[model samples]
Target: MILKTFGWSFVITAVGLALAVLYDGWTAFGIVAILSILEISLSFDNAVVNAGILKKMNAFWQKIFLTIGVLIAVFGMRLVFPVVIVAISAKIGPIEAVNLALNEKEHYKELVTDAHASIAAFGGMFLLMIFLDFIFEDRDIQWLRWIERPLAKLGKVDMLSVAIALGVLLVSSMTFATHAHLHGGAHADKGETVLISGIAGLITYMIVGGLSGYFEDKLEEEEEAELEAEEAAKKSGKGGASAVLLAGKAAFFMFLYLEVLDASFSFDGVIGAFAITNDIVLMALGLGIGAMYVRSLTVYLVRQGTLDDYVYLEHGAHYAIGALAVILLVTIQYEINEVITGLVGVVLIAWSFWSSVRRNKRIAAEGGGDFSEKAEVSTGV
Candidate 1:
């Protein structure tokens, strides 16, 4: 399974590097290599989150995620998305944007960097909600009992996650807005820009998340009806509820969920890439390498049943995500070092992996089967 999952990723990396060398020689290749590593370091937590959602999807959809979805990740995002953003932001045509990217890379990079505040706000808020929901929900296992226990109780408040997020956004916007005016930088009204951008982020979260939850509820109702019918048939010794995931809005929403999630995660990588190199092609090739590996890792986690085996892994990933979200928000005004960003996530996930290993030993010693099965039952795996 590991080979089958990562084999193509290695091939993609080889091809990307070869193309990089041919296009702009070894200098470009080096930049691509750095960008790829940067992307991987920043987004390992994203893979874990993707795995948790991917396991719920049917095999066909999963294939789409790995194949069709990858094109979107590599080209649509790494290549085209930046062009679109630049074209719109600079009030130029797509042709002009492409020229800008190729002929005047520094100016193009500046435009992209200038857009960072809004990008950070949108991505940060979406991810913040994901973390908040996980932390606030009632769970069978509590990794950090003292903290999570209280947060779960606080979850009972209606729209608690959204409320808390808004409050945080409010505080951040005010503090930064005040700071921007006092600092007297290039942006004259950055405070207002930050505020509006943040509200846009909240609205986006509401629409996408609401649609996802609504369809999921409908899917659950249909499943319950099928289960009831299955129970009746079982009384007469017949087969059980259907396990197949058909093509429909529910599946479509799941796809949307993943795509948007990926786009949000891409914001930091895109902006950070400017810091490394201003060449768009090099940035794309490098980030593409990291993206392919992340997709492969997502499939690996799902097929290997890693989530089930490492019970606290998802918790750790989400916690890391929560931290990343806050860091992105903070970066709106300050220039944070990428090294610090990567290390925090690595530490949290490593800690969780260690905890899960210890947990498995305890469960085995107590004469229980793999805790993965129990985690599945609790998590609807």
Candidate 2:
């Protein structure tokens, strides 16, 4: 199972290194490997969050997520999306944008930096919504219930998210528009326009994200109903076909929600990666490798039952997400490096792992007496 899971990753790595060798030999290979490792380390929390969703999906969709979903994440979002962003930002044609990246590497950084403000805006708002939803929504778990009642009284986080996003847009627009005379550039007006554009993106994300959440809840309800019906049918010796069909449908919608969640997570990673390198091929190769590792890590989490074993892990990831969202929002007013964002996630996830281990040890020690009692009783039997 492990080999099957990682086989495609190895193939991708081999192909990436082979291409790197053809282009710039061992040095390029090393760079790609290093970048891939860096990306993987930074995205550990992403895998955990993904696992929570992936566990709800059926086997077939899980395969699709590993294959087609990886393609979209690594190639479509990481590679093509950056290029498209560059083209728009630089006010150049696609070919010219490629040429600019290849020839004018130094100037490309400025374009990337300019692009960050807007991308950060969208990423920030989206993540804020995620954090708010998690904190506000009622989960079956007890420890998490404390915040739910208070958050629920405040109303839907989605509504608050929309209002906050619009406020950000209005503030950014006012700043840019008012200060237009203070800063002169090739596209001064374009700078002001980004604020409005970013708000539109945020609104779109809100609509999609909210609808996805609603659908997910509805699916869960339907699955519960089906399960109850199935239980009744088995007791009465009746048909179970309808229940099975409902289960399949529930899994399908769960899969869709997982993909949407993945896309949201990728938005920041994809945009942040452009800061490191503008070469679409290299970006795709590097982030693809990272995406592969994250997928493997997710499967490992499921197999290991990491969340069930380590209670604090999810809480830490959500906290980190919230922090990242705030950082991204602040970047609209002040620049924060992508390295910093990546490092923040790495540190948070590392801390969570350590905390999980500590927690498990404590649990084991506390259960030691019970185990001894059971051993004595068994021996008597």
Candidate 3:
């Protein structure tokens, strides 16, 4: 299973390293290797979140995610997205942006860094909405009961998630974004830009996430109908039929949501890549390889039923996402080290994993009679 899951990633790693060596010898190769590892470390929580979503998708859609989705992630976001941002922000054509990236690498990096405020505002708000929605929803499993339970109660209010997300956007735009340095220490009030970008982000999340949910509900209804028919057929001595899977509009919208979520997660890593090297080709190779591994890991977790085994893993990933969203907003004014961003996610996930292990041991020692299920219903955090 591991080989089948990670085979493509291993192939991509070999090819990417070869290309890096051919690009500028061993130094470029080493840089690419480091960037790949950095991306993987920063994105471990992403794999967990992705697994939770991908498991709901059908086999065909899962293949689409591995193939078409991979192209969009590696080239569209990792490569083309930055260029598009530079083109728009620097007021230049796409070709000029490409030339600037290749020739004036330092200048290109500066443009990308200067554009960070807008990027942070957009990605931050989008990610914040995701975290808010997750935490606000009432669930049988509460990872942090003290906070999550109250939030869940308040979540009964209409549009609470959207209201809180918009409030955060407004506060950040007025405060942190106003003091942000643009164009390499040239201070300017970025409040207007931040507000506009944040609104766009919030609107994007609403449209995409809303449509996905609607379609997913339809898919669920279809699945239930199929299950009913199959059960009836079985009782009547007819052969059981296969359950319907996510497809059509449902699958497409879900796929779209996944890609956008991936883009939100990649914002920090794409910008942070500049700190390592400004070579566009090298960055694409490195980050692309890392992305493949993440997708592979997602598939592994889903196939192995890791989420069911360690239910708190999903909770951990969401908490990490919340930390990242706050960090992105904070970075609008203060420069946060990439190391801190990466470590915060790793630490939270590690703690959750430990909690899950403890829970499992306690269940076994107590002669488990659905104690795990019972524990999920308990008010303890």
Candidate 4:
């Protein structure tokens, strides 16, 4: 089942292998392979999160995500984005950035990693919001009832996530300042950098989320009208943006949301890949392979209704994302291992998966062999 949907991933893997062999030999090939696995392992949460949103979209948009979106994932986020980061941070042209990546590889990596505090701040905050929104929303099923119930109750307090995130940023900033001062190096302004980037991330999320939510309301209206065929004024989402703004506006916004979400998720992997190899091309190829598989898994999850089946899967993914967000912020002052970051997500997801399986067995037994029949009505949170 996975193989059929992930055929494109196989093609990507083969192409990456061939490119690694042709360009840098077997060592590079091995590095590419490791990078691919690293990306997949680190980004399983991304796949689930994407699926949660993708299932809301129509088939056309879903295909666009798999096809056009994959190109952006591989080229834009994996390569050009890094070059742009280096270009802006290093005050060099894109070509110069590429040259640095190729020629002065160590310096290139340093430039990339040097910008980590801000990157982590921005991405971590964006992700923290995602996690907070998920757990804060009133879900029917409470996987971790003890933790989630209180959060849900607290969510009624307006801007709880924002307040909590800002508080963490402030504390992180203070800790960062003290750490930099004591360490006696170029870390003097890291706390300030984190604050600025974290705010920018928060703003980006509000804009993107706001736009998407507005369009979603419009789409829902259209969905309601179509359900009754009561009016021709309401256009189907498939027919395009329904004369709302411009052509493809709805889908385009969805596309934007997905791309930004993917970028935030990829920030870690892109930086982490440097630890494995300095070759930008190899990193792109290797990580691109992983990205393709993640996209495939997203599509597979959407088509197979995995989220609906494993009720806690999305919850688990968000919790993993929340942990990652905290870890990213923590890494600003402390050097955290990528392996630990990856493992945290894996462990949370695995526990949730196991819990889901047990849940299914219980449901099956209680419902006299048909779990799906009472699944919708079952109490979950």
Candidate 5:
């Protein structure tokens, strides 16, 4: 299994890098490798969050996630996305955009610099809402009737997230709107207003993300009830609905959620990567490599049952997400480098892994022995 997995990853990486090399040669290879590692490090939190959803998915969809999904992630989003953004903003065509990125590298840099604030604002607000929902919303399984009753009745659903996003949009818009005019300068040109794009992105995020969450919760509840029923039926020696179908449906949404989560995480990395290299091919290669690592890490979490073993891993990732969101928001006024953002996530994930290992060892010790001892006992040692 290990060899097969590594072999597949090798093939994909080689193919991706080969494509990069075709476009830009040896320099492209280096850029992709570095960017890939950077993206992976920055997105460890993304992997953890994805594992939470991916673990619940059926095997087939999970394969799609690792396979087709990676293409969409690395090429579609990481590579093509920035080019598209540049093209739209610069009022140039796609072919010209690509040519500009390759030959007129400095111009590409200027384009990314100009768009940075708006990207930060949109991505920041989207991630902030995600963080707030996770932290403030009730996720506990209500097993007891008494507790569920009053809790459900009195639980005030917080709209503070929406309000906060709106506030950010308003402030970003007003600030950009007045920035040039107040300086007795020329009127801000179209597609140059950070405020408008920021507000639009934030509003779109709220609408799409909110609706997704609502449906996700509903599906999750249905799945939970179905699982319980199946378990009960099994206890009574009866058959149950195909677990795979239910799992597939559950996984589909989880996949969607994971993609959205990835997009959120990639926001900063995407913007920061432009700061390093404006070669579209190089940017794609580097960021694609990073995305591959994240996919591999997500699978590792599931196969290793890290979440089951380490209770706090998910919590730590969410905390990191919250911190990233805040950092993105701060970057609107203060520039925080992508390297710093990437390092912060790496440190947090490393700590969580260490904590998980310790917890697993402690549990094994408390259980009176290791797996070898249990095996011996079962064999009548």
Candidate 6:
């Protein structure tokens, strides 16, 4: 299963490095390798979140995610996205943006960096909404009971998640966003840009997440009906209906949400890659390899039922996302090291894994057959 999962990632890594070496020298190769590791480390939690969503999808959609989705991640976000940001921010044509990226790399980096306020506002708010929704929803399982339980009770309030997210955006705009740290040297009035971008992010989440949830509820209902029908048919000595799989609009919207989630995660990686290297081709190759591995890992976790085993893994990932969202918002006014961002996620996930292991041990000592199975049943997995 390991080879089946990561085989293509290995192939891509080898080819990407070889191309990098051929592109310039050992220097280019080193940069590409570093960028790849950077992307993977920063996105580890993202892979966990993605797996939770991907498991609901059927095999065909999963294939589409691994193939067509990788293209968008690599070319669309890693390469062209920076260029587009530069083009619009600098008021230059696409051809000019491309030329600036290739020939005038430093200037291009400055332009991209100048646009960081809007980028951070959008991505941060989108991720904040995800974290808010996760914590706000009442569930059978609670990893951090002290914190999560109260939040769940508050979740009963109508639009609590949206209200909190908007409040945070407002506070950020009034305080951090007004600071003159972004946009090449010192500048003000960034609050307006941040506010608008944050709202756009909120609206986007409402649209994509709303549609996905609506269809997912429908799919769940259909699956339940099919299960009931199957049980009845079996009692009468007849064939049962096959299990329902996620497809049609449900699958499409879910895929869209995943892509948007990826984009939000990639915002930091994209902006940070400029700190490592200015070559767009190398950035794409390296980030592309890391993205392929993330997709592979998502599939591995789903197929191997890792989440079912480590029940709190999703909780940890969401917590990491919440931390990242705050960090992104903070970074609008202050410089944050990428290492700090990566370590925060790793630490949270590690702690969650430890907690899960301890829980399993305690259950085993109590003579429970399998805590994982018990957890699955409790959560309706």
> Using TM-score as the measure, which candidate wins?
3
Taking the tens digit of each residue's C-alpha lDDT, what string does model 5 give over 1-381? 565545666776788788878877887777877777778778989989888878766678778889888888987789777778788867889999888777888777777666556666667767777766565554332212243335344445557657766776566555543432211123342223555665666676666666556656666777788788889898998866555554555566567667766877888888778666777777777787778778877887788777776655675687688789778766655567777887787676667667556655755877744421221201010
Report every candidate's CA lDDT: 0.83, 0.65, 0.88, 0.83, 0.68, 0.88
Candidate 6 residue lDDT tens string, 279-310: 88889988988898898999999999888888
Q: Which stretches of candidate 4 lie over 4 Å from their true place?
A: 177-187, 230-248, 368-381
TM value for model 4: 0.90
* Runs in model 6 lying further than 4 Å from the true structure: 232-246, 375-381
Residue 246's lDDT within candidate 3 is 51
Whole-model lDDT, model 3: 0.88
Q: Locate the minimum summed-lDDT window of 10 residues in model 3.
A: 372-381
lDDT of 2 by residue, 26-100 (tens): 777776786687677667778888787777676777788788788777777666666677798668898887777
Candidate 2 versus truth, CA RMSD in Å, comes to 6.5
Backbone clashes in model 3: 0
Q: If both were scored by lDDT, which would come out higher, candidate 4 or candidate 6?
A: 6
For each candidate, C-alpha RMSD in Å?
3.4, 6.5, 2.0, 3.9, 7.5, 2.8
lDDT of 3 by residue, 1-381 (tens): 988989999999999999999999999999999889888888999999989989988888889999999999999989999999999989999999999989999999999988899999999999999999999999988777888889999999999999999999999998998898665667668899899999999999999999999989988887888789889998897865454445578888989999999999999899889889999999999999988998899889999888887778888899999999999998888888889999999998887777777777777787775533655643323
- Looking at candidate 6, the ten consecutive residues that score lowest on lDDT are 372-381
Q: What is the lDDT of residue 353 in candidate 4?
A: 77
Model 1, C-alpha of 121: deviation from truth (Å) = 0.9
Lowest lDDT sum, 10 consecutive residues, model 1, at 180-189
Estimate the overall C-alpha local distance difference test score of candidate 6: 0.88
TM-score of each: 0.91, 0.79, 0.95, 0.90, 0.77, 0.94
Per-residue error for 8 in candidate 1, Å, reads: 2.0
Better-scoring candidate (TM-score), 2 or 4: 4
